[model samples]
Target chain A: MIYEEVLSGHQQELRRGTVVMAALATLETPGYGYGLLAVLEKSGLSVDANTLYPLLRRLEKQGLLDAEWDTTESRPRKMYKTSQSGRSLLDSLTAEWNYLATSLNALRSEEPNTPLKELP
Target chain B: MSSLSSRYVTAVSRSVPESQREDVEAEVAAAIADLREARLDAGTPPEDVERAVLLELGDPMRLAADYSNKPLHLIGPDYFPTYIRLLKILAATVLPVVAFAVMLGKLLSGGDAGEIASGGIIAGLGVAMHMFFWVTLIFALIERNPGSKEAKPKWDPTTLPDTPPGGVRLGDTIAAILVALVAVAYLPWQHFNSPFTDAQGQSMPTLNTELWPFWIPLLMLGLLATAVLEFIRYRAGGWSWRFVAINAILELLVAVPVVWLAATDSLFEPRFIGRLVTEGWLDASLHLNVTIIIITIGVVIWNLIDPLRKVRRDTAMRAKRVGSLG
Candidate 1:
């Protein structure tokens, strides 16, 4: 259980940065908070509503996300989309991510060789 | 809007900034409605969905913190170190001095040993609490004020002072200031009434009343100087030659008058001493004058050596850093 907790913590830390990138990328198409959560989950990036809602508001405040309230349906929904600046930020972040992945792969390949044993 | 949804919106809006309240409330309300609608479309019970949605959003206060960018802590990590440092300084310096003064006052008033001990403890705790309350309140204000600049400036590794090993903390200096203030304020007040009296009904003051006009003002001035010096030392974060010089001057301002008063046998009323001696309450052979003078000189010498030692330690650290770089 402790090992799982530690693993989960490390996983959360790793996913935190990726979640931001993924959110910005997915929000290129306009979506409400709940709708966006579904899209993110379907894409294998599960985030809590409490976390997602605040992130959306912070992104809007930073001028990286645009939001509009649509009252056309029975229930009003606040739809969010990536701003032009958000798209630009997404591109730069993607480039940086690629560079990091490539460097990490290179370092992994340089590790000392180990013999693999067949499972009994 | 449903009752739960409206309640959540109200709770969040109450904690948020006034300007952002309406917008935040509207956004939260819309989010809740969307969640409810989605659940209803999927055939989930309306009652179950409403409770689930609010639960998923977690505490309204925490949500409000994220929206308003206000920290949940009283003093944020940024200012916590400095706050604690100042607190320690007060606890070390001011607490002991206040305790000593109260103990002395009780003793001179002919209070029993237990009463003196308890009185000292109460006074020390009271002053320490006041120091803690005010310091925390100030730091909390700084943390909450969005317009307030950062307490510490941007860091540059090369320019940063080397952390002296077991260095004299900023708290010690602040404690000194607090102690001085207590002493300056308490001495005059305690002197106003005689705690002792002779069988002939003559009142005997703690200090000679004649020393009031010349001694009190000079002592206060010296204390005020120490306060100013401590304030500067706190801001600088470490010792320098300049701090040492100012500290020496202030120590002299305080120590000279004290030594002079003791040497001239003007610290305590001679009549009071004589009466106590006559009553066999005090030893006739006791050299009260010489004892006080020695104590005053001892404190002065100690104060002078403390800053000089810190200065030397700082200098040595800097030289080591330079030597390594070279």
Candidate 2:
């Protein structure tokens, strides 16, 4: 329960920043909305449309994404790719995220009795 | 096939802007359709596919709304406080330019103080018009998009008040009308002679002409038209292509004329620009002012036209697609 509470709070927020990176990384090859969602789910980061659609728009607005409509099929799909700016941002964020992960892991390991202490 | 999948897709397509919606809808529908097809291909009964797809798609309105990229706030996402704030700033900045332009015009035209004041206010109003239209547009788009965080700092959904946002109220309207009436009352006469004298002591040329060459009136008219259009859209709770077409037409009608007049020096006095160049700022500021005005006009045209072009192109494309589909 404590682990769940911690995950739903601080850990989730920290992971939230990764959504952009995850989205950008997945979208580098040009994926549509549902396509990206499937990729996210496969990668263990579930994204709802309510979050992804707006995030995509925001990223595009910020010049981090380039999108185009593919209408060759029976239905059309808007495909998005990472822009040059997004690539750069993603690179930086990835490095920072890795560093944070390492640092957090080190801290967790340093506290040898941390998990034991949390027991009721 | 169950009607649910078709209904769901149709609903999703509606909330989204037409230009990109087709592809979006296709992707979504195809995803569902593929599943249905697979079930049939796998020897599963087709009757159950509709229920499954409908259930998976969830509420048509919410799914479409989410897909539409409409903002989360009740007030809407397309509207932004920062945009409004910028508009106010632009309005403030444009007023002085208008005042200076009108004052110089009045002095050149040999108008009374009242005429100068009225012209200045009109100029301010013109700037206000541009501020209103562009700002409203930017905010409206922001409001429409549920995903925009541009207004995140200022807009709060959980605590959003039940009443509509307060803007220019009845008192403000009355005040504006009174001001306009004053401007009309203080109109410059046809025969008021110029007070400007060149450094060489020769009398400056008269400023009297058929009209004032300021772009303010056109900007005002565009704003007024847009306001009326928005009011209609507001009451109706939706927008139509016809409304957009009318808005675009109004913008062109007002902007093109005012810009033409300002560029040609036909509206104010024929001699206004000439005197301002020859007499004001020893002519350098006149050149600079003209450049600034031209640049401003260019920017306004670009900003205003860009959205209209997108809207028109998207709407046309949608129509073509729908036609083809039929």
Candidate 3:
């Protein structure tokens, strides 16, 4: 029998890189942390809020995201958006993801032990 | 402010740096409030929702560590090898030497068995503590440095025992910093409390007073930089061309101005020279100045050449070993 937890753990690992790309893409519309969390969940990336919040802060530290405390509400919320560098990063990450998918698919369909052709 | 959510938030905020505490606290509190409201709106029981929210957020201390980019450990694994190696070397070399020296000194002073034994043991313990404190402090700082994290290469078991990962001795680094610090302190001390006195009996500075406002402090600043560079070179571990370049730059920075000043007869004070000449301890034939220039240039050249040789030797040794293995 397949272990559900094991499968989910692997699934979580697979989703990890995608989650960064997702958050960077979502925050381009300019939203606060909790709002970004909801958007990620809606898109089928159920990132733990604990993980997402810290990650957002880390990205901001790396200059991949810009953050400002929005004081419009009674409680101030820190809003984040992808920076110019982040936009470029998101695009590159997206291209790389697609390239990986294509490579994986090619391997799957490949007949056993046919020598791998060097990339052009 | 005393609510469960605030409590949860405060736990994390308190762990981060104080400057970030207010901001992190406010942000975390707002996040927790948002989570609780969403959970409550879904018709979950109030108690369960708040408890679940806190549980999902996980350990506040860990979160704070992540937020502040502080490692949970005192010394990270990257520096652990060098740290262990340093302690082992100290235990083998310094501790026994210091203990024996103290015991000898105590015996010469006609101390009994009890006094000698106690003095030796105390001296060993003091030296041990001093070494441990400094070595651990340096490794901790290196671990905390952001560049250390990025520089962490993937560990390959096959690369085991490949030339000592850390090139320089920990003793050398500590010695550098200590010597520089003592020299820096000695400057100020000698300025005020010099054994050399004027005709009116005021203690006069040994170094030329005219060099005071600019050159002396510049020399001290250069010493401080040398100390910092020593620490950096030690932390960086492996010998390289880069370190050799930095070494040369630093040597010139300290030595050039010094040798130039000495050569121009501008380094030592007139009073000190007068005292030496009047006492027939020296001639006016530029003997001392020439010696100073010779020693300074010799040291600078050795300092510059030695590291370059080590880096080349290490690289060749590694290549030869890899070839032999193949």
**Which numbered prediction scores highest in TM-score against the true structure?**
1
**lDDT tens digits, residues B1-326, model 2?**
25677677777777777885775566567657655654577677777766765676666667665555555454443345556557667766776777798889987999998998888888777777777877777676666555665536554576543763222235534553554444333333322434554456545433324444444444455556655665654443333467666766765665566556555645444344455666544664345447645765785577466545545554555566568999
lDDT score, candidate 3: 0.83
Task: Please tell me which model should have the higher DockQ, number 1 or number 2.
Answer: 1
Candidate 1: where are CA atoms >4 Å away?
A112-120, B153-326
Q: Give the C-alpha lDDT of model 1.
A: 0.82
Candidate 2 C-alpha RMSD relative to the actual structure: 25.3
Worst 10 residues of 1 chain A by lDDT: A111-120
Q: What is the lDDT for B25 in model 2?
A: 68
Model 1 Cα lDDT, one tens digit per residue, A1-120: 899999999999989988779889988998888888888889899998888888889899999999888879776778889999999999999999999999878767863342223324
How far out, in Å, is residue B261 in model 3? 82
Interface RMSD of each: 1.1, 4.3, 1.0
Q: Return the TM-scores of chain A for each candidate in numbered order.
A: 0.89, 0.80, 0.89
Steric overlap count per candidate: 1, 24, 0
Docking class of 2: incorrect
Candidate 1 interface RMSD (Å): 1.1
Error of 1 at A98 (Å): 1.0
Model 3 chain B lDDT-worst window of ten: B159-168
TM-score of 3: 0.50
Question: Per-residue lDDT of A1-120 in model 2, one digit per residue for the tens?
Answer: 898998789977867888999998888898876678767888889875456765776688789999877788666656789999999999998898889889889868877887678899
* Whole-model lDDT per candidate: 0.82, 0.64, 0.83
